[model samples]
Target: MTTELERELKQLIIDTLELEDVTPEDIDPDEPLFVEGLGLDSIDALELGLALQKTYGIQLQADSDDTRRHFANLRTLATLVEERRVK
Candidate 1:
């Protein structure tokens, strides 16, 4: 079952990225957020990161390996946000 954080992150991703034809229910928490899955590109990553920071007040270190892991999928992203969220 999907957690509330995962659902919220899925919705945030769809809304922040302006993903047409996609909904939170359509996203798989374990699926990758880029190329092979959602097909998001580098620019989308940047935009998503900015949106996450603004919305959650969490700091993301661009060069950290954890950042890459965090962005791997909805579940990981939600885990990261839950760990770091200040709001």
Candidate 2:
């Protein structure tokens, strides 16, 4: 089951990446966001990172393992936003 945060994140990913071929309903929260599931590349990651920061006031370190873990999928990304986003 997808949480509200996950749903929102899915839309954010779509909008941020200009994924005209994708839709929020098409995204599987458990699937990988990069290289396989969504087939997003490193450039997509950078774009998504800026979108997340701008939207949620979340900060990230470039090339960090923790950042990689958070970006692993929709669920983890939502969790990161929930935990660190400014109110």
Candidate 3:
């Protein structure tokens, strides 16, 4: 991913997760920041999903089964943005 994309993803993560201790520079592209890394729980996922819809206009259907893949990590989120951008 490009630097701009990475930075945007970092900002999204920080904003969505309400991570007061983390900065854009702290997130690793390939690292998992949910269960095993950042310890985010299911509530965080719900909140992040809502925030993502509002911020990026990428609607993630709550009833869909792709929630895991969509919120997998920073890499997946960034790729989703690149793929779904309105342009």
Candidate 4:
């Protein structure tokens, strides 16, 4: 059901971060997006946040816990986009 959005979010993460070695198929929707799992740093988070905002008209707080939650994984990101994206 949520597979399509998850793939889109995965592609967004890959492109937004310019991760040359990572592909959407390599990402696990349930994996953590940070240090332990995908190993994304804070900078990647910022870039990805911007991409999400530009692509979906989603707003984010740089230091918000809610932002942390929404960035936790591909599924979470897809959920956020689904809930808050403007058209």
The prediction achieving the highest lDDT against the true structure is: 2
Query: In candidate 4, what are the lDDT values of residues 1-87, reduced to their tens digit?
Result: 448778888888888888899977789888899886899998888889889989999977666798899989888889899999995
Show how many residue pairs clash in every candidate, following the order shown.
Answer: 0, 0, 0, 0
Judged by whole-model lDDT over C-alpha atoms, candidate 1 comes out at 0.88
Whole-model lDDT per candidate: 0.88, 0.91, 0.76, 0.86
Q: What is the lDDT of residue 49 in candidate 2?
A: 93
RMSD of 3: 2.1
Tens digits of per-residue lDDT for model 2, 1-87: 999888899999999899999989999888999999999998998899989989999987665798889999998999999999995
Give the residue spans of candidate 4 off by over 4 A: 61-63
Local accuracy of candidate 3 as per-residue lDDT tens digits, 1-87:
456976987888798778999888778777776796677888988888777777777766566457778677778878877777654
Residue 7 in model 2: shift from native, Å?
Answer: 1.0
Tell me the lDDT of model 1 at 69: 88
Per-residue lDDT, model 4, residue 29, is 86
Candidate 1 RMSD computed on C-alpha atoms after optimal superposition onto the true structure: 1.1
Q: Record all residue pairs in model 2 with backbone atoms less than 3 Å apart, i.e. clashing.
A: none
RMSD of each: 1.1, 1.1, 2.1, 1.6
lDDT (Cα) of model 4: 0.86
